[model samples]
Target: MKRIAALFPGQASQYKGMGRDFYLQYQSVRDIFNRASEVIDKDVYSICQDEKMLQRTEYAQIGIMVLCIAIFDVVKREIESPIQFFAGHSIGEYAALTCSECLNFEDAVKLVQIRGTVMGKFGGEGKFAMANMGSASNDVIMEECIRFSDDIDFVSLSCDNSKEQKIVAGSSKAVKRLVEGTEDLFHGKVINNLGAFHTNYMLEAQKEFNETLCHAKFHEMKKVVFSNVTGRPYFDETQVYPLLGRQMVKTVKWRQTMDYLKKMNIDEYWEVGPGCVLTNILKREDPSINVKSADKILKMEGTGNEKIC
Candidate 1:
């Protein structure tokens, strides 16, 4: 028996027509889009199909969530293997929670809608931006960030995607200054966005999101779920809400989460959302690990046994 871990993709993974194939083939997937539309009061299917509408942060977040869950639903119907662990990146975490039965689909949809609205509103108030630092060690990035913090308004390490790929977020001026000063050390590129997420810059958004989470109900996890903030499996239901609140203003410990999963001796890994972002990260981390995308798995001749890793 193989122990399977499912990874969900977050923001930056959305693309036009992400779930169109799944939506057309499965009524269950179409029903998910319908429910999402009713809850968010937006035609999610149309938004996902249109490249322009999918670019807006608020719309993109909800659209990604709907598509992720829909893809997971279709995969679940086809595969009977029991998932040993569920984890997602950023917004994808809600989909993991839904998979673990920690949150209902309707509630998850509404919460993400509120989360997207709050983040979009508060995120654009400043000249915030995010940048990816390639071919750099975590310690080096952290050291540079700290060194520049004395002069920069807000400079902090955001996502530790892998050993060689890290992200930084802060005010645009601060990020630009840091990048210019350290240009010789590593390859860097600024991501297009208004808000610096997973840093103190999102304090206001975190507070507002906490209020919304207070009303949201969470159930006991049916399967082990890892936290992007803590990079560990949640011990109990009590840790869910607070960790999620803090996740908005904390660095995503993705590399650490991957390390933890490897330590657990997980036999197989599955990327259950749009794009191959998480899957590619996992492959780079360890080529020997067995991994596959659910979308490709669905297209195979029979219950797909081929592994991409």
Candidate 2:
């Protein structure tokens, strides 16, 4: 049997009609969507179809997580390959956990709704910010991030997507400084963030998330799941909640995650989510690596890999 790594994409991978085809074709998917709507009372079915709502961090996070799981639910039954590993990018981790059986689908939806609202309240509302910086060595990027985070406002080195991709989030002032400080040496894009994700700026949300998590039941992982905090499979079932709780303020070690997967001799990388971002990112890192989105395994045409047109 081929060793498989199942990955999930994060926010910004959402589209207006991402899960519509799946919902239409699969009764199971429709049930998942409807249940998600009832769990959060946000009409997730309508949220995915509305452009304005999809753009909001709070709504987008919930919709994205639900879409990932709904798609995974179908893909799981279709695929013959046994998955050896699983990882999600940021908010995608919730879906990863849900699929891993660490958290139930209803609890996952409820958690993401709270996550979105809090993140949107802080980062999306303009209190906090995020930016993608690149075209420089990792050392240079870390130096600048550390300086701003320590001396200036709270800036965090958020997502390490790859050797060339680095994300930072913090106070708006600090992120602005990050952009200005690196403008001469590198290129960057300021992202519309719902919160200072994976940064200390999310402490308030982390607290609430922790409190909420206390009420949610987390089971042992049914399959190996990588954690953003460590860029490694969770140490044990007991660490699941704590790691997830602290995940909000920790850097997502995606670069390390890919490195770890390679070391594990993963033969195929499967991205079971709305966008191909996770699979594509891995491909860019190593062109020879085998990568596939859920569409191929599910034998479906619309995986929402393209922009909604």
Candidate 3:
């Protein structure tokens, strides 16, 4: 028995004209991109065409959501499988909602657009995140995180392909402190993210996002969508709004979420957006599982199916 799980990627995973392929291929994809352009009063296509827009936080958010949604739409029409669940990283949660039908594509795009704007506004300056690669236990890293939580906030703990590799999110000051405290110091390599995301530092943006989502309409999910906050599957409409809001300010529980899916006997795992990041993470977590990037998905050309561990 194989189950299908769709993984939606977050911000830093974006690339140029991510939706152009689908936009040229699917009317629905074009319509969705056009609707997003209308909501923001900017030519999203132009933004997609321009390299600068795709790199900026705000435009990157819109482009990524549109592309991810479009990819999901293509899969829905072209492939048939018993999809067991859906999950997303950070802003990718909105993409999960669209896949689950909890929110319309237009509304989901609007939400993320505003989300990116708000994040840029309140996430403050002089703060950023860094990804650390290594083989370390969560508890050891978490203990290290807490040692600096007072200033660093230890906003996120991402389980990479294996227990030894993980990404930590926090302010520059705190991250620096943690690195200095640790032996080998991330093996001397750290990727500085554009902002301090997924930590308490973004709470102000989360507040505004919550208010906006509270007024929006969400339907009960026809399928399971996992919450990054709790690392659990939730399909109730009532829970969706709160969960999405908390996501901005909470740690992404990627490790627990995947484990939960494995326990449910998921068969296929598809990373539905740009980059093979999630696919790599899943494979590292369990090499026996079958996972593929969205490009691999499009190449399948038939039943884009696989078994997750």
lDDT of each: 0.83, 0.80, 0.74
Best of the two (1, 2) by TM-score = 1
lDDT of 3 at 240: 82
TM-score of each: 0.92, 0.90, 0.87
- Which pairs of residues have clashing backbones in candidate 2? 119-194, 124-194
On lDDT, the candidate that comes out on top is: 1
Q: Can you write out model 2's per-residue Cα lDDT over 250-286, one digit (the tens) per residue? A: 8999998889889999887878777688877877878
- Pairs clashing within candidate 1: none
Error of 3 at 205 (Å): 1.5
52-79 per-residue lDDT for model 3 (tens digits): 7776777777777777887777776654
Give the poorly placed runs of model 3, Cα more than 4 Å off. 82-84, 149-162, 185-188, 296-309
Tell me which of candidates 1 and 2 scores higher on lDDT.
1
Q: What is the lDDT of candidate 3?
A: 0.74
Using TM-score as the measure, what is the rank order of every candidate, best first? 1, 2, 3
Residue-level lDDT of model 1, residues 1-309, one tens digit each, is 678888999888888878777777779989999998998788989988888877667788888888888888766655568887988999999999988889999999999998888888777735788888886887788888877775447678899988877999988877887888899987688876657888887899889888989888889877999999998999978889989989989999988999999989998888987789988898987788898886433445585543222
lDDT at residue 116 of model 3 (Cα atoms): 85
- For every candidate, C-alpha RMSD to the true structure in Å: 2.8, 3.7, 3.9
The 10 consecutive residues of candidate 3 with the worst lDDT sum are 300-309
Candidate with the larger lDDT of 2 and 3: 2
